[model samples]
Target: MSIQRIAAAATAALAAVALALAGASPAVAGSPHFIRNATTASLDGVSLVVDFKEAGLEAGAVETIQVTAHLDALYQCVNNGGKVPSDPKKTTISSDVSESDEFTAAKNGNLVGTLTVDPPDAASVLDCPSGQRSTLVSVTWSDVIIDDLTSGASLALTGTFSA
Candidate 1:
């Protein structure tokens, strides 16, 4: 190959990498990684499928993390002919709940966080039947993490909520 051609090729490759780095989201700054996989948790009528990508977390570093999970309480109104309650606070259950637990990263490098759903109350919008539990609220996480590891990376975990 000619000297000019080789230099041009090298320059193009460098530019391409620069562009890719420039366009990357701030959350995923250092150490590109992929989430281990999806995990499903079912308690009472609440169901969740959680997945995320993380970097810089050591295999044994336990940290306190908080994630703002977006909830879907549509099922609470299903029994009432799909009628949504006028008062947001009058839902079958409270969508805003906090869960705290010591999470241990497994050998496979997965930090699993499970949100415990509150059981439906009697004043819930839906007149649920016995054993026909309805999920008052279903929530999802968005790259929620705590503690800084060796690298700075963002978590973008997203998936469908099956409740």
Candidate 2:
């Protein structure tokens, strides 16, 4: 009876080991972790709202996020006695900009937040030629991306903010 019990236990252990090995998978280290609840970036009025997350960071880690983008801004300028509808004095200017901010990661390595971009406002850009007045009508941002400058993490965002 003792011999039969030992043999049964050994067989069961071997079968369990075989099943566990069949279900195991290789771990992919250094891969970017994606957050499911992140919101899509949007433009609020004349400002842009950056909503996103950076994964694979230490819990409560303080990090700097850098944003680089191409911007197309439309400015309406008053032309000296220019035709009202026929000669709408509007100018479209394009530029590349880089911005940065710092934040702390969550306990689960997700750094999430909303960034409001409204500064670097070029009211002076309204300084039109020939004593004309100008105002920024609208702006379009493209190929916008965020990078974890502190941790050197991979890209986290690539959304276009336009009205």
Clashes of each: 2, 0
Question: Quick one: how many clashes does candidate 2 have?
Answer: 0
TM agreement with the true structure for every prediction: 0.36, 0.63
CA lDDT of each prediction against the hidden true structure: 0.44, 0.68
Highest TM-score: which candidate?
2
Candidate 2 stretches greater than 4 Å from native? 1-39, 78-90, 119-122, 129-132, 156-159
Question: Candidate 1 — which residues are off by over 4 angstroms?
Answer: 1-44, 49-55, 74-98, 106-154, 159-163
| lDDT (Cα, tens digit) per residue for candidate 1, span 1-163 | 9999999999999999999999975442234243445433333455333333444445655645433344445444333444444533324332544344455554444465654534334345555554343435543332323222333333434443445
**Given candidate 1, what's the lDDT at residue 69?**
42
lDDT of 2 by residue, 54-115 (tens): 78777777888766667788877655564333455676778776767888887777788766
